[model samples]
Structures are given as structure tokens and as C-alpha cells.
Target: MSEHEGTYRTFTGKTYSLYGINTGTNQYYKVIKKLADLFLQQCPDKKRLLFQIQKASVNRSFFKKRSGKNINHSLISFIKKTLRDSLSVYTAGVKHHLRTLPLSQRFDSTLMTKEEQYHLYMLEIELVNRIYKEPFKSSQYKFALLPHCLRDFRPDCHSVPGDVESVCKECTERCFIHLGSLLLKKYNIHPYISVTMDLEKLFKRLKAEHPSIGALGVACVPELVNGMRICINLDIPPVGVPLDANRCARWMKQACESSFNLKMLEALIK
Candidate 1:
């Protein structure tokens, strides 16, 4: 990890952006922003959004000294503008303040609360559903729809609902396929999608060009199997071309050794 560059920026810079991954840039961000906006549009009425963001609780020192300018400004401006009229532009792009909004600021790569993480996961699912037009209410179809999402393999549509492990594997396989479908539908060209960053010039120019809401994955490997198995292949340090990202061999092997620390802090003053 660079001592100077914050993890969030590093991660953002390093993160496998969906835009250039496959599909067109416009197609990519539109679908992501559309669903992300859906979750965030109704955010204000419920205190959950604010509380969730607060729960993330980023420290100021974590902000980078230099390059953190864009995202930091973007985030603050988003907060201010969203405060103004979170409801008005909920539908489509209608003078979103993203351009006028500060494009840079500084912050840490903080861990979002379970609620924030849950919303992220929800955004991920919505991304797939929006692109594929999958029925939002049912898991049965999503399980089957998963295979078609990934580009590489298309497992014959067969429902395995009983065994947890089999269901989990199927769910992962299908999600990847669906992601590919999303890109293809959006871009109309066979754009290469990967969990690795390979932007070249596309990554640098796009954010400045348009505004968007960030999301994790539905088509991503960190998928939900039978609505239970949350498989996240957390990586080690030194971001480079992933030889086998999903196969985070060391991370997977030491699963039990690694602790999942969750602290449930309740209101003291309230």
C-alpha cells in the first residue's frame, strides 16, 4: 500500500471498473447509475441513508494529501446537492449537479456498515435485474438467469434448490454470465469484461465526462447464492494483474483463520 494514497482512492483507481470492462462507457454507467439512483433517490425520507453513511465514519487524516481531490469534491458536492432535492431528479438525468459539484475531495477507504454494505449488495442485484429485465421478486429465475450472464460458460438451465453448496456455485457462475449480458446489451459490442483493471485511457477521462453512483456487483463474483451464501474473494496487497482473482487461494484457504469482526454499537445518548 502506498503510504500516501488512501485506500479508497487506491481501491477506486485499482477497482475493476465496469464501464470499460465490457460494454460501452455510457451503457455501463447508465445502468449502474440508474439502479444506484433508485436506491439513493428514496434515501432522504428514511434516516437510514444518513445513519448508514455516518456509520461508515471516515476519519479526516485518511484523506490523501494530493490526488484525493476529485472524489472528495464529488462526494461533498453530491451530499450538498442531494440535500437540496434528493427527490426531484430521481428518475433520469435532469441537470445532475455532478458536473457543478466538486469532483475532488479526500477520504479514507472506510468499511461501510452492514446496512450500507447491504444497500451496496442491493444495488448490485438491481444492476443485473435492470439490464436483464429479470423479475425482481423471484430467486428461481435469477439462479437460472445467472448462467446467461457470464460470457465464458453457459451451464444448461437446471434448478438445484436443495443443496446449499451446488446452489452457491450455480449462482456465482450465472452472475458472471449475466454481467457479460449487461455489457453487451448496453454497449452492443463484444467488450471484454474482467474483475481486473485494464482501462488504458478510458478510466482517466470517463468520471470527468459524466456523473455516476458507484456499486459492487450482481454479475460480480461476490454474489448471493440461494439468497444466503455471500462469497467475497478478498485479495491481498500489491494490486497487479490478477492471475486468478476469484481463486484468492490464500484468502480462501485461511477463511476460518481470518476473523469476521462485527461490533454492534447502540445509541448511548439517544
Candidate 2:
């Protein structure tokens, strides 16, 4: 129902741009913007707002299930109003709302909890599923970028810098990182560890080498969100997988150790 100057249609019949999608319901977008603002402010009433938003979402879900393809302007208007009102709640369930939001759009690292970060990352993973279904099949040039945390940090495990990026020593047998590396090698996918957050630099190198590259990244929620935003800004198509759990020093108060569902990750390869 919308048109943009430079956009491409995906296999799913959805059109998007690395530039951006500028067409969406104004009311819906407005509510989203407002929620993002409140999130940044760390408003105290976030919980109450989240409760209302959740109720509205449930109602919307029910309606869609019962009346698929019967959506009307009035229903949309009602939903928007519900969201707007919910966001007005004072010092409420912000964490609950953050848990449901896709990528803490306005996430403040200073205020965000590890639990909220995990939820936001999960949302990003959900969005990746919707946006880049069967990504490996669609992307000609792809890279597998996994987090360094996935490395086994126990005794005798060691990692060192590589020619292009940090190299996984691949010391631990049967670990998720090892399995992920094997899968990438099997698929002929360029694999790298995101030790540095400067993806623009990495992508610049990738452009020089591959000319055009899409990325299949594995990271925690905050890092995933940060990487995705950078990719979007750079017009790079990326799909992502979140870690199974948060094991970073911030969350665990110790050295980091992370993993993912190898099966889920391999599914993206083919």
C-alpha cells in the first residue's frame, strides 16, 4: 500500500530499503515514537503503560485471528489510541514493555537491566526471522559474524587476533563456536568474530573484497541491536541470532561464557 523511490521486494512480497521504509500508519508510528521517548527518559510509569499496551495487543491478536483480512481503519485507530494512552501511565511497568519491544529502540545502556537487554535481543531475533526468511538462499555474498563470548573461556582455551579480525583458536571440541565455525566453513561463508563494534570498518573491507555482502550475525541483545542499526544505516542486509543466555561479566559478575542453539544457527545456512 506504500511506495518508495529506491526499494526492493523480498521473496515474502514485502518491499523494503536499506535506505529506510518511510511509509507506515502515522498514528501507529506516532505511538511508537512516543514510547521510544518515554523509554529513553526511563519514566517511572512504564509498568502501567505496558499493562495497557499488552491488553491492547491481546485484543488486537484476537481480532486478527477471528477476522483475518477484515481489518478496518477504525480498528487500527482504536489500537493506536490504546497504545498512546498506555504510554501515558506514570512510573509503571516500563520493563515489561521493554521486554515486548523489538530492539529497545531507545534503549539506554545506563538504565537498562540485563533481563531487559535479553528480551530486546530476543525481539531482534524475532524481527530477523520475519525480515530475512531463508536468508542464505537469497544472499549471494554472506558472512557469519559471531560474538567472541561464545568462545570457551576456561583454562587452556585461548584466542588471538587474526589477519582481518579476532580469530577463534577453536580449541574446545564440540563447543557452539567450533560447530558454528565448521558450519561456516562447510558453507564457504566468511566467518569472523565481532570483537570490535566498528562494523562500518569491517563492512568497508567486505565491500572491497566481496563488493556486496549480507551478514548472518550471532550476538547478545544489546550488541545485536547495535549491529543491526549500523547495518541498516549502511544499507547492509543482515540476519541475526541471539545468544541462548547472557553470560557476560555485567550479567554474571564473572568472565563471559555464551552459547546458542547450533541447530537453529545451522538452519540459517541452507
Candidate 3:
């Protein structure tokens, strides 16, 4: 196996101050590859690696010829095995604690297809039943009734930037908790919630036009009132966000209720 060469250059002065083993040369690549394999195993969110299938598949950036004897191009292939390896350790440190949640999370219409919406509704009912009708661990624990927050209404659960399957099971739980609280308080019911109402795959359920499926996968759109802007990027994992002009335009027309027309919004796109 040929060794991979690594180089470094600073195009942007913004260097990540975080520290980790960088596979900056062929020797380190060999060790890094093995370490990365184990690193994936040790990583808490191994399932997240499923999101990196594309990164792994098109992993040829390491093999490109360099100009100098050791290496020519000053800039390193940021996408090489080194970054992925370090990312395993570096990525896992993020911690997200839900400050407040609303009752039954909602989604932008474009990101959500009619089918997914239907499924989630059904799931909500079933899970509520289990919480109320069939007593479970969650109910007896004494969950608080909390007011709706931005994170609660439109949650970027998976934290992936643009993948269609933006909903997270954890976020689903938050939705139910909100609904359960409302039901319990209003109706004096046992507070049961449904479990089944399956979650649909992001790509299959929605038309490819959803902007939430494009730049912001399940992103929390800022609610700007009185000239105050608050944008919260769950800042989870990065994922591929593919977009089409026509699809984007059609999506805005449907989702935003003519409030936004992507085609007409020239500055926004450019």
C-alpha cells in the first residue's frame, strides 16, 4: 500500500484551536486509518457514521499527486483520513440540553410531506395512549408542563444539516411530552401518547424542493420580532445539502404561503 502524503496551508486565518492527532503524512495515515476504524467503534454516535457514507465512498482526496517531493500544494486535503479521524474524537464533545420544549413539534410544510405528517400524527396518538391508557415509566416520573419554545416547535433533532430525515426520536419524545402535558392538564386524562405512527425517510416522503431539506435540514428559522434575531443551529453533525432552483422555488411557494417566493427573491439566492 502506497503511503499518503499530507501538507498544510492557511487559506483562512481561522484555524480550529482544538487539538487532535492530525495525519499530516503517509506514515500517520496508516496509523490514522487503523485508529479511525477503532475510533468509529469507540465513538458514542457510531450510527452517525451512517451519515458519512458519501465521505467514505468518495475518499480519493488522499491519493492525488502532489507537486513537491514530499508534497507540493501547501494546503492539505482537509477531507482526508486525518480530519475524519480527529473528527471522531472532536465531534463527540458537543452536548445539547433542551432548555424548553413545546407541545407536539411542528415542521416546515415543504420539509414535511403529507405522508410523513400523517405518520407523525398517528404516532402521536399511539404514544399518548401508552402514556395514558397503558401506564409506562415516562408518565410516573413526573414530567413538568412547559411552555412552547422555538426548539420545541421545530426541532433539528438529527442535527444533520440537509438530510431529509431530519426528525430525531428524541425530538419526537419532546413533542409527545409537550402534548401529554397539555392533555393531562386540560382533560385530566392519564396522558398517554402513541408510539407506532412510523417516521418516514426524509428523501422519499418529501418532494425534493424543501429548503429545510436543502440549506437547513430541519433548521430552526429565526423568529425576528422588533429587530431582534436569534438563530440557533443545533450545531450537530454536518451533512450533504443538495438543492435545485426549481424545486427550491416551488417549495417556498407552498411552505411560506406566498410570504416568500424564491424566484423573486434575487438577493436572497445570489
Best by lDDT: 2
Q: Tens-digit lDDT track for model 2 on 1-270? A: 322212212111011111112232232224344544544254234333333332333334464566444334453345454433542221133355346545644454522433322333333444444455454446678777887766646656566777666666788765566667777778777677767667779877776776566777886545666676566556566767655444554334454555554555566666
lDDT of each: 0.26, 0.51, 0.23
Ranking by lDDT: 2, 1, 3
lDDT (Cα, tens digit) per residue for candidate 3, span 1-270: 311111121111011111223322223223334544543553323333322321232213433432224331221232233444443332221121011212232243322222222222212222222222222222222111111221232435332222322222333443423333343334332222222122223222332232222111111111110001011121111111011111112222222100111121121112
Q: Which candidate would rank higher by TM-score, 1 or 3? A: 1
Judge candidate 3 at residue 145 and give its lDDT: 13
Relative to the unseen true structure, what is the Cα RMSD of model 3? Answer: 23.5
Task: Note the clash tally of each candidate.
Answer: 17, 13, 15
Can you give the lDDT of residue 143 in candidate 2? 77
User: Which regions of candidate 3 are displaced past 4 Å?
Assistant: 1-57, 61-72, 77-205, 208-270
- In TM-score terms, candidate 2 sits at 0.55
Work out the TM-score per prediction: 0.23, 0.55, 0.16
